[model samples]
Target: MEMIYLDNAATTPVLDEVVEAVADCLRNYFGNPSSLHRLGIRSEKLIKEAADSVGAVLHVDADEIIFTSGGTEANNMAILGTALARQRTGRHLITTAIEHPSVLRVFDHLKSQSFEVTYLPVDKSGLISPDRLEKEIRPDTTLVSIMHVNNEIGSIQPIEQLGRIIKSINPNTVFHVDAIQSFGKLGLYPKKWGIDLLSLSGHKIHAPKGIGALYVKKGVRLQPILFGGGQQRGYRSGTENIAGIAGLGAASKFIRRELETKSAYLYDLKNRLVAGLKDALPQAVINGSLESGAPHIVNIGFPGMKGEVLLHALEDEGVFVSTGSACSSRDRTVSHVLKAVGVDDRIAGGSIRVSTSYLTTMDEIDAFISILASVVSRVEKYSRR
Candidate 1:
């Protein structure tokens, strides 16, 4: 049987155009970008062009883009760099309960160094209220980091509204958004939304795995996370991954060109999947807000069976899914995102996330549902025995 891959929220397969771009860079642009020779100049120029292409997608200047080793590094650079730089001004930060480990772990690290962090609670739909954020901001609050879309549940956070609230309460406070999941899927107006720093991952959008970018508004101050020859305008250091950068640039252009039609297609697929699940297994409970969620992800739970058990069963049938964020899947713990949204232990433990990509087709989705219904029935039957 042909494999039906549905775990796109973890990572996407690199595109053919992106592969060609990377190969061209590796074959021809072998000189170090920092050298004074013609080959170095050519390499530097290629990187600059890539930056411009990626920046165009976000409506920001090329100077604002800092390439890093994917979303974890981007989020770390934004959180740690900003906190250390602004510590003299204030030592307080704000974030949500359901943030990815990259953002939450940074906060935990800062807390060890005497920073105060307020983790705002989410509603049953995995959403934070702007009013609650307004209440949390203090004159000493230095940063507020939030994700544009939840990686596990696909809940769309009110980023623009929260941005406005953060600025209104504390204009000096820096607002950092992790847009790794939403960058290519939805429209992002960082400037208009008052976002000071934004993080994105190339792998999430069919670019190479070891590359991503952080958008830093022109004057936002951030201390360096790495030190060496001052690459990325001294924000991130070390030699640039020329081939990965080229692939990232090509992928950004591709996604921008396809965003409109691709999003519509994924939305239709999601609706069909949700409806099919409800019709086939009425006992399954959806874990997040379906109406306001991202177009490609649907997280649901079968009350009595374990998600990992079902996931393996589906894999046996050549259907791939996930229990939660791929980064946390190895921990053997229930999803923190599900618990934050008030899913009880029983349901959260049994939840699985099925995420699609623009490349996914309707036939594959129908086949997945047909196979999933059978798997759930078998697992639940075994449990009752």
Candidate 2:
């Protein structure tokens, strides 16, 4: 059987152009960006040009961008770096319960250090209300981190509204957005949105893994997390990954050029998959607010079946999808995101995430639905036995 890959939210296949760009950089530009020699200068120029491309796309200054290993590190640098640097201002922070582990874990670590953290709850639609946020703001709240789009359910948060509310209530509280899942797929203007910091991952947008960026609004003070040769404006100290950065730059350019076309295609694919699942399994329940989600992901739960069982059953049929976020999939635990949105444990336990990308096709979707229908039927039969 032909394999149908539907796990784009977890990670996407690297675009061929991106692969070639990375290979070209690895082959031709292997010099350290920090060295003063000719080779080093050549590498440094490439890094600067890459930064310029990324910055231009995001409408931020190139100097404000700091390259890291991926979204996890970028989030760590943003949350921890900002809190530590501005600790004198306050020791309190705020975030949502649905944020990725990167952001949530960093906050948990900070809580261990005596930083008060308030995890605001989301409504049934998986949205954090600005009104709820306003009620939670304290005098000591120094930073507020919220994700632009949820990784599992693809629910788009009211970021611009939240930003305005936070600024109005506590202008000193720096606003950070983890846009890893939304960056390339959505229209993001950090400055205009009042976002003080934004994190992005390359792999989510068809670039290679191990390369990501944290955009710090200029003049925002953040303590250096890594100590080294003062790279990334001394904020994230380390030699840059020239090849990965080159791939990221190329990927950014490609996405910028094709976003409108790619987005429409993804929207169609997602709608088709959701409609097919609902039609095939009328008992299937979608997990979040459909109207407010990104076009590429849909989370569905089937009653009386385990998510892991369905996951492997589909895999056995040559269909690929995910239970939820790839990072948290191993635990076999119910998704916190689902619980936050009021999904019962029974339904949440059976949830499967089917995500698509620009590269996904109609044939893949049809094949996936066919496999899924058979799998769900088999699971139901076994349960009845």
Top model by lDDT, which number? 1
203-291 in candidate 2: lDDT tens per residue? 99899999999999988989878888888778888889899999899888888876745657777887888788888888999899788
Q: Clash pairs of candidate 2? A: none
Model 2 — TM-score against the truth? Answer: 0.97
Model 1 stretches astray by more than 4 angstroms? none
Model 2 regions more than 4 Å off: none
**Candidate 1 structure quality by residue, lDDT tens digits, 16-103:** 9999999999999999998999999999999999999889889999989999999999999999999999999999999999999999
TM-score of each: 0.98, 0.97
lDDT of each: 0.92, 0.89
Instruction: Name every residue pair that clashes in candidate 1.
Output: none
Scored against the true structure, residue 51 in model 1 reaches a CA lDDT of 92
